[model samples]
Target: MTFAELPRMGSGRVSEARRQHFHAQVQEVVVWMRQYVRRLGFAPVARSWLYALESEGKITKGDFTWASKWLADRRKEGLIPFELVGADTTRQLTGHDNFDEEATPREYINRQLRDSLEQAAMYWPSSYWKHQTNYPILWSEKKDVLKLFKPELPDAIRRFAGKGQADVNSRLAVVQECQWAQENDLQPVILYVGDHDPSGIKISDGIAGNLRQIAKVEDWECGLDEMESDGRIVRFGLNADFINNARLLWIDGLETARDEAKGTNDLANPRHPDHGKDYVQSYLLEFGPRKCESNALIANPTAARALIRDELWRWLSYAGHKQWEAENHDASKEAAAAAEGIKRMLAMFDSAGVLYNPGLIQSLAQASLPGLPA
Candidate 1:
């Protein structure tokens, strides 16, 4: 039985019939979740999965907290594959022991050397935006939302601006990126995705100003007006059109950082300190009392990926791809020339009777090489 159906701590026992019903429901949920995840192809975050189920009438909105806990327990018991759920990068393990016990120290050294050699053989031109006039950075308000569509954004720098405004570190990183891009004769641009809410709308609108402010503090002299005039910082998703077309879920209430801190509910409420703000008033007039999160796009992964790809294609032109192909051809020729030089160097070592020495190879793997990081 659900929590609401349970008796008070010591009042009475549950009927066996009700108990059986709860068990049957649990089994049905498990089977449905398996099939659902399998059909979806990619694992969505827990909230998105809940939204999908709710939309299909498999569960009510009230079931979220309990269902999430139940699903997590099942995953922990190994009833579900961990890969069936997207990882939450917020909570993480760091600096932990990550050694492999299956290999001996000598075997590990051999594997490392072989891996390095394999990488050397596969070298290509490393620049992704090499032929593009403008370098695009994919910016999302939420990290979880960004993770949903990040794989399709291969040609852009991915950045997650956490809740509300970006942190100081995030702003500094973008400023440094813009500085480097300008130095290399590239124009930096941001493709933004955020919720369509009071704060979310304003957050995307203020990104250029945020970057410019940080750049100025660092003594960088570049005009961000071009980013605005040329439509560089484009808010491409979670807008009214995308939400309506994608059939996204709209959440009730105008929640903000202040509301969260104060343990209050809606920012549009008269009692809210931020209710009188122009952005809040505008959002309320435009959207009523509901807001759609960018995460709602996670319910349809195919459309989500396509949305990002279409925006990227606008900047990545046909001419750019041809230029990239030409650059790759030249890079491959240089790689072949380097390979010949390496072969000659190895032949000299072979002539000296030391090319096939296993002991020397082991020593070289253990020692730090010259002109490389230690």
Candidate 2:
């Protein structure tokens, strides 16, 4: 409610004029903030932004949903997904164009049924852990690193975004996600890529620290002792080794080199003071106290991907890939077997009916795969 709407004093407490004046002063600030948020929202809604607003008290915890509604209104006006929250997606019936594209009705039904059966039967392997004694990989994100990687990743792996010193909520979210993975009987292996500097270095620690604290306080199923012994976290890139070897270009001044809107960074951020006991003296010695943002590594997208692939392959092998393929082939055979009776039943009905529009199904039983009776 606006300040002006507050109950007036009975007598000599505060005048109605004073109340209105106070409200006008307060509304000036609110109006400015509302305008600012509206302008920023020309872009897609983000979980990070929602969290930020809650932290800043712009949106109260009790009214957390207000920001989402505000963003949704903007999205309806036509804003593409930044992360594509499934809840905010356009809902459609089975008659949608995507269902019919390059497909016959029988084929579509057969496909839908087969897929449902596949899910129900749980024929697919859940993860690398289910396949073997192996564990899951947790990959980290930095500015546009998501844009660089290929879409496909193994079932045993998950991805997360860390803009910088991952805010408390984001950090806690990461902790919960990793903890959930551990509960599912998968060893957590965190593989991160970010700025090769103080804040980036500390972020990895910050996440672990918060996770450890929660595990202890909450008496989680997977305790800190187990996590300390079994869990593994490693920073894999933009290291001095890769920097010197790959010769990733640098921008002498990060403050000057950044185009905040574009999110383009020149790597050499001068924010952190390079100390004698910095994590890697070689990095400081070679780069001369210069910083390297995560993008510097992926600047050569081909090499960066190759590097990540090589790291993942250390955990996953060709045998693992083939194991998945073999499982898939068996599932395909099973689905085909289950669908055979339906095809025959449809084929018989077509012959019995005088006015039957026997198009593709007729062609299928009379001509398609040999399993269906002619």
Candidate 3:
């Protein structure tokens, strides 16, 4: 519901009834968040939960600061588990090693051995994307997106262009990977996701131009211009339709990194420097001053994942890829069988105490190779 729909409060003293009503709303929000956390099976970032609440009409963009503090308060009060809130890895300290110990070292070794054997039996030597018609690289405008979609997309190589622009080193590395893909006769394609703001839209639209410039300056073997001509960069998310359909919340003002850093209103604001620029004017006319962040997509996790997979399957089918992987493993069945046989032999040697008898082992080695000196 919009702010206008909310119950108006008197500017004077808050009545006991009004206070109780506000408390009831906070409890409702907490209960809803708990359900959402359970659905996800893990604590996502606080903003993700906020977006979810926004989509549900339980809160608005302006409620972020107040809601965030409320959530933290509830968590501290033991109404919510601490694990129900995701931690920021950026500020985490390094060189920390803390873990639950197993019953014993031998038990750990046995468990590891069993895991190793299982993996060996199922291992495939071929690359996951070997037979695909196109080589796809997943790109996101923000690094935080990596947390939501990366786990589901194991085979796709990921590149994060933080704030929609790749630095020189990142550009060089991605281009090199694309070159390798091209050499293998695969069409290099970048499946991109970004915000639904002016800069985001412009960056998505300019991906091919940027890549073309990179390839030209680097003098790469593959013609990125010709390759990208067939709509190689696919911006498959955070569009107007998706935002409306998903019921995402939009921030009221147009704010950029510079505006944020300088603590000033800029970008599309009337008092700002570039408000009258064509790009700014066009964006303001089309999308207005409000902007939806790409992180808002995390609110609808299943649909967001489906959107990614739908684009991915255009180049490679999930069933086809799995079948190919199984076939590759089957082709190496002899290796697995040999490994099993070797495991059995080692077990027998250990049981017979032959492994501990160094002199016996030397004699056996000499017996196998008669030319060895006594």
Q: Please give each candidate's TM-score.
A: 0.76, 0.52, 0.78
Top candidate, metric lDDT: 3
Q: Tell me the alpha-carbon RMSD of every candidate.
A: 6.5, 15.8, 5.1
lDDT, candidate 3, 105-141, per-residue tens: 6567566776787777766777766757777888788
Q: Please report, as a residue range, the 10-residue window in candidate 2 with the lowest summed lDDT.
A: 1-10
**Scored by CA lDDT, what does every candidate get?**
0.71, 0.53, 0.73
Candidate 1 wrong stretches, greater than 4 Å: 1-24, 34-42, 60-87, 98-106, 257-263, 322-374
Q: Name the better of 1 and 2 by TM-score.
A: 1
**RMSD to the native, candidate 1?**
6.5
Better by lDDT, candidate 2 or 1: 1
**By TM-score, how accurate is candidate 3?**
0.78
> How well is each residue in 190-295 modelled by candidate 1, as lDDT tens digits?
8888889988899888887777778778877354666678788898988897788877777777766443444566887877777888988988898888888777
lDDT of model 3 at position 250: 77
* Candidate 1 vs. true structure, TM-score: 0.76
